[model samples]
Target: MTIPHFISIGHITHDLVGNGITPGGPALYSTCAARNLGISVGMITSFSRPLLQPGLLQGIDIRCQESQKTTTFANLYNEHGERRQIIESVADRITSTLIPPEWRAVSIVNICPVANEYLPEIVRLFDKALIGICPQGWMRRWDSKGQVFRKKWENFKEVLPYADIVFFSEEDVSDPKKAVETYLPYTKMVIVTQGKLGASIYSHNGVHRSPAFPTIEVDPTGAGDVFATAFLIRYFETHDVPESARFANCVASFVVEKEGIYGIPGLDDVKRRLNVAR
Candidate 1:
C-alpha cells in the first residue's frame, strides 16, 4: 500500500445546529483540503458506528477507532460573529499506539484536536515529518454541562517544540498576541488567523501579514482548518512562509463562501482565485 503524504489526527465530529446535523472537525476539513491540493491524505480519527458514513471520506484513507459516542458539538452563532459552543457528546481519545507503525513516517502530519481527543505524546512519534498543529482544542475547556470556554494551554511547552508550525484563530485564545509570543520559542512558525482582517505569521524574521481574499460570507466553520492545511501543503512545497500564507488565504476564501464541506476548494478553484488575486 502506498503511504499517504499527509495525515490528520483528530475526531470526526457531528456538528449540531438547530435541527440540522453535519459531520465536522479539523480532521475532515484538513484532510479534504490536503487531498484537494493533490497530496495523498489519510486520517486517524474516532467516531461512533452510527455516525460513521462509509463513503463520506471517499478519497482519503481513514483509520477509525470505534467509540461509544461521536464527538458532537452545537454551535450557536450571533449576528456579530461571536459563537457559543456546547459539547453534546465526545468520542474516544486517540493515542500513539492506535496509529499504524508504517504510516508514522510521512511527509506532513497535522495534529488537529477538536475535543482534546489527541494525546500530546503522539507528537514525539513523527520525528522526520513536518508536524503542524491546529491547537484550538487544547486551548478549550468545558464545564460539567459541556458548555465550552477558552482556557490557557497548560501543555503547550511539551507539544509545541515538536511542531514545525502551529495554527490558531484569534478567538481561540484569550489574548492572541500573547499566545503567539508564548509558542514562538518552541515552534518554528506561528500563525494567528483573524477572519476578514487576514492573518499574521511570526517566525525568526519577525511578524509578517498576509491579506485575506475577498468573498461573500456564509459559514466560517472550517475556514481555519482549511487555511492551516493549505498553508502546510504550500509551505512544504515552497518553504516560503509568506507565500504559503497567501496561498492558504486564497484557498480558504472559497470555504467561507459556502457551508460545511461544500466550501472546500479544489486545485483548479484555488488556482483560479490565485490568478485573480495576482
Candidate 2:
C-alpha cells in the first residue's frame, strides 16, 4: 500500500498523562487529528504487545515497531499545571531498520516521543517533508522517586536543523526572551504552546501568536501534541501560519475540554470551532 499521507515516527505509549493514565503520544494524538482532517497518517512506534493499549494501532495505515511493551507512566498534577510524572516503564529505542519501508512516502513526520525514541539517523532517512517535533516526552527527567523535573537537552541541535517545525510548551519557552536567540536560527518555526493562554510562533520570516479558543480545561496532557499536529498539517495545506495556528488551537482547546486521548475531535468538529472563531 502507498504510505499514509502523514507518518508520525515516534512512541506508542501508555501515558499517565496528568491526573490519570491513558494511551497517548504523537502516534495516538497527532495521527488521529491528522486522519480526522482527511489526512492519511501512519506510525512507527515501540510497544510491548501486552502493555500496548488494545486497538492502539488500528485505523493507522503504516506502523512499525521494535518492542511490544511501550512506555508507561503515572502522571500526577495540580490544577495550576505543575506535574509529577513517574515512569513505570520505558519503550525500546526506535531505529531506521525498525521503520516500515513505506514510510518513505508519508507527507509529514513528527518525532513524537514519550522518551528519546527517535534516533537522529532514522530521521535522516525520510525525504524532505514537514518534519515536525513535539519533544516534551524526550525532554523529561525524573528524580529517584520518578518525580519529573526539567533538565538541559542534548542532541536537539543535531536533529533540529533537520526539522521544518518544532514544538514547545508554555514551560518549554518560559524564557521567550531567549527563544529567538536560542531557536529561531535553527529551524523553520518554533511553536510555544501555552495551553488556554495560546501559542506563540517564531519563524525565520517573523514572529506570530494565536490565542486558544476558550474552553473548560480538563486534561492538558497531549494538548500540545494535538496542537502541533493540527497546526503543522493545516500549515501544510494552506501555508498560512496564523490561520493554521487558529485551526490547531481550536482542536487543542477541544482536547483539553475533554478527558483523554480518546477525545481528539474530528474535522467537522474542528471546522465548527474554527468557524465560531472566525
Candidate 3:
C-alpha cells in the first residue's frame, strides 16, 4: 500500500454535550481536515470498537487499537463561551509500536493527543517528517472525579525539540506568556490560537499575527485541531509562516460556522474564503 501523506496519532473520543453524543478528538478532526485539503491521510488511534462508526473514517487508512472503552468527555459551556470539561472514560495510550512501520516516514506527522495517551518518545519515530504537535492533552490533568484541569506539560522540553511546530489554544495554558517563553526556544515555530482574534506565530523572526476571518459562530468544538492541520499543510507547501497562518485561519473560519465535523472545509471551500479575504 502507498504510504499516506499525512498521519494523525491520538485517541478517538466520544464527546457528550447536553443530549448529544459526537465522535471527537484531534485524531478525528486533524485527519478529516487533511483529507479536506486533498491529502491522503491515515490515523493511529485507540477507541472502543462498538462505539466507533467505521463510516466516519471511511476513506482513510486507519489502524485502530481496540480498548474496553473509548476516551469520553462531557463539555459544559458557560454564557461567555468558557468551557468546563469532564472526562467520562479513557482509552489506551498510543505507543510507538502501534505506529505502522510504513507511516513513520510520512511527509507530515501530527501528534494530536486528547487524553495524554500519546507518549513523548513517539516523536523520534518520524525523524524525516514535519512533525506538528497539538499538546492540549499533555497539558491537562484530571482528578479522580474526572474534572479536568490545566497542568504543566512535564515532557515539553523532551518533545518540543523534535517537533517542527507546536499548536495550542490560549485556553489550553494557565500562563500563556510563560508557556510561550518556555517552548519557543525548543521548536522552530509555536502558535497560540486566540479564537476570534486569530493566531499568533512565534519564531526567531518575532511574532506574526494572523487575524481570524469573520463568520457566524455555531460550534467551536474542533477549530483548534482544524487550524493546526490546515496550518501544517499550508506551511509544508509554502514554507511561509505568515501565509500559512492566514490560510489556516481562513480554513478554520468555516469549521466554526457549523457543528461537529460537518463544517470541516474542503480545498475549494478554503479557496473561496481565501479569495474573499484577498
User: lDDT of all the models against the reference?
Assistant: 0.89, 0.75, 0.89
Q: What are the candidates' C-alpha RMSDs?
A: 1.3, 2.2, 1.2
Error of 1 at 171 (Å): 0.4
lDDT digits (tens) for residues 213-276 of candidate 2:
8987777878888898898888988999999998889888888877667778888988788787
Model 1 segments beyond 4 Å from truth?
Answer: 50-55
Native-vs-model 2 lDDT? 0.75
- In order of listing, the candidates' clash counts read 0, 8, 0
Q: Model 1: per-residue lDDT, tens digit, 1-278? A: 77899999999898885688878899988998998888999999989853435666778998888899999999888998788999989999887777788887899999999999877888999898999999888889899999999998988899988889999999898788898888999989999999998899999889999999999988888999999999999999999888999999999999989867778888998998888878
Model 2, residue 106: distance off in Å is: 2.0
Using all chains and alpha carbons, the TM-scores for the candidates as numbered come to 0.97, 0.91, 0.97
Cα RMSD for candidate 1?
A: 1.3
Clashing pairs in 2: 5-107, 47-67, 47-68, 47-69, 48-68, 48-69, 48-70, 49-68
Report the C-alpha displacement of residue 93, candidate 3, in angstroms.
1.7
For residues 125-168, what per-residue lDDT tens digits would candidate 3 score against the true structure?
99999999999989899999999999988899889889999999
TM-score of 1: 0.97
